[model samples]
Target: MSKTVRIPRRSRAGILAAIILGICLLLLLTVGVLTVGAADAHPPRLVDNAGLLSQAEADSLRATLDQYSEELNFDIVVVTTNTLDGKTPRDYADDYFDYNGYGYGANRDGALFLRYINGSSKEVWLSTSGEGIKAIRDADIESIFDDMEDDIRANRYGAAFQIFAQDVRDEVLDYRSYDTIWIFVGLAVGLGVGLIATNAMRSSLKSVRQQRYAGSYIKGNSVNITEARDIFLYRTVSRVAKPKESSGGGSSTHTSSSGRSHGGGGRSM
Candidate 1:
C-alpha cells in the first residue's frame, strides 16, 4: 500500500503560474528567432551570389545601396552570379528579385541589375517592378547600359557596377522631380507664346505704316521711291511635315517565373 502526498494549495498555484510563464517566454523566443531569420534572408540591397566582390567591395556597395534606396523610397538591387542556374538573364533576374522579396512599398517598387557571367556568355540584365518600372524608361535604361558597356568589356567589374548604380540613382531622382520639370516646361511655353504675340503686334504696326504710305501716293522726304519691277528668276515654296511625336515611353513588363509582373531590358557585353 502507498500513501499519496498532497501538495499545499499555494504551492500548486505557484507551480501553475511558473509553467504558464515558461510557455510565454518560449513563445516570445520563437517569435524573435523567426523575425530575425526573415530579416537575414532578405537583404535590402546588394546580393552578390557569385562571390565576385571582395568583402570590402561588397560592404561598401551594400552601404551605398542602402542609403540610396532609402532616400529614393525604392529598392535598387544588384545581383552577381556566375551561372544563371540554367535560366536566361532576364528570367533569372526577375525570379531572383521576386523570390527573395526585395522592394519597397505595397507594390514592391524596385529595380534589379543582374550580372550573369557564364563563361563567354556574360551579360547584364535590368529589371524593374511597380513604380520602378515607371521611373526608368526603356530608352533611359539602354543609354545607361551603353555607358557601362566599355567598363564591362574591359573586365572592370567593380567600376561597371558603380556606374550602373550611379546611373540608376540619377534616373530615379530625375523621375521624382517631374513636377519641377513640368514647371520649367510651362515657363518656356509661356515665354514662347509671349514672343509670338509681340512679333505679331510689331507686324501689325508695320502693316498700318504701309497703309498710311499707300494713301499718300507719293514719296515722303525720308522715303526713296523706285520704278516697280517684278523679278521672277525663281519661285520657291517650302513645306515641312510635322513630326509624329511618339507617345510611348517606360519599361516593357512581363510576368516572371514567380508570377509577378516586371518591367525590364537586357544586353550582352
Candidate 2:
C-alpha cells in the first residue's frame, strides 16, 4: 500500500483567526480616532478673558486655537492681567501663576514682570526670559506673562506684545509629549464602545434571522375527535324518530325487538 499525504485541514482555525483579527483591527481603529480627536480648550482660554477679546480678534484666534485643539486633543487656557502698582518679581511673592493654574515658578519662585502684546495662531508671550528663550513651556509661559505686567503698566504695549508672541511661538514649536496611559485609555474606551454597539446590532439581526427561518416551514396535520351521545327520560327526546300516529283504523304504533309497540299499528278487530 502506498502512503498518501494530506495537508492537514486547518480551514476552520484559519477562519476563526481571520474573524478575531478583523475584530481587533476594528477596535484599534476606534481607539485611534478617540485618541486624536479635538480637545476641550479652543482659543480664548484662561476662562477669564471671556469678554475681553473683540468679536473680530476673538473669532480669528478662536479659529487658530480650534486647529490646535483638534491636533493636540487638549485645552490651553490663556489670560491677560495688569500688574499691581509698584510690583516687581522681587517685591513680593506673586500669585499670577497660582491664580492661572499653571503652578508656581520653577526656578525663581517669583512672577516675572513684562508686557503682553498680541497673540497669533500658536503663541502668546511678553519678552525673552532675559536668560534665553527657554522653549515656551506652559510653566514658564505664565512667568513670561507676569514679567510683561510691568511693561504693560508703563504703556510699552508694542514691546510687551512682541516678547509675549515670540515666546508663545517657541512654546508651540516644542509641542508637549503626553503620558502613555492616556493614549491607552483613549483606545480602550473607543474599543469598548465599538464592541458594545456591534454586539447589540448583531443580537437584533440574529433574532430577526431566526424568526425568518422559522416562518419558512408550514404544518399540515389532521386529528380524530371523539363524539358523544346523550340519553334521558321523561318529557325529553330519547330516540331519533319517536312519535304517536294512526295506522289504518289504529293509532300509530311501532314494534321493537322486545315486542313493545307504539300507537301506529293496525289491529285485527
Per-residue lDDT tens digits for candidate 1, residues 35-74, read: 9998677565777777777887788888878878888888
The CA lDDT of each predicted structure is 0.84, 0.41
In every candidate, how many clashes are there? 0, 28
Question: Which digits, one per residue and each the tens of the lDDT, describe model 2 over residues 1-269?
Answer: 99997654697788888999999999999988877663332123332232444555555555544444334333233344333344432121123333332221232111122222234211232222211123333355455567555655565544454454444544544533333556888999999999999999998886454436643554445445598788775585566776744343322223322232211111010
Q: In candidate 1, which residue pairs clash?
A: none
Give residue 163's lDDT in candidate 1 (0 to 100). 81
Per-residue error at 243 for model 2, in Å? 99
Model 2 lDDT at residue 112: 25
- Candidate 1 lands at a TM-score of 0.62
List the candidate 2 regions with Cα displacement exceeding 4 Å.
1-11, 37-50, 62-77, 80-163, 166-269
Candidate 1 deviation (Cα RMSD): 13.4
lDDT of model 1 at position 179: 59
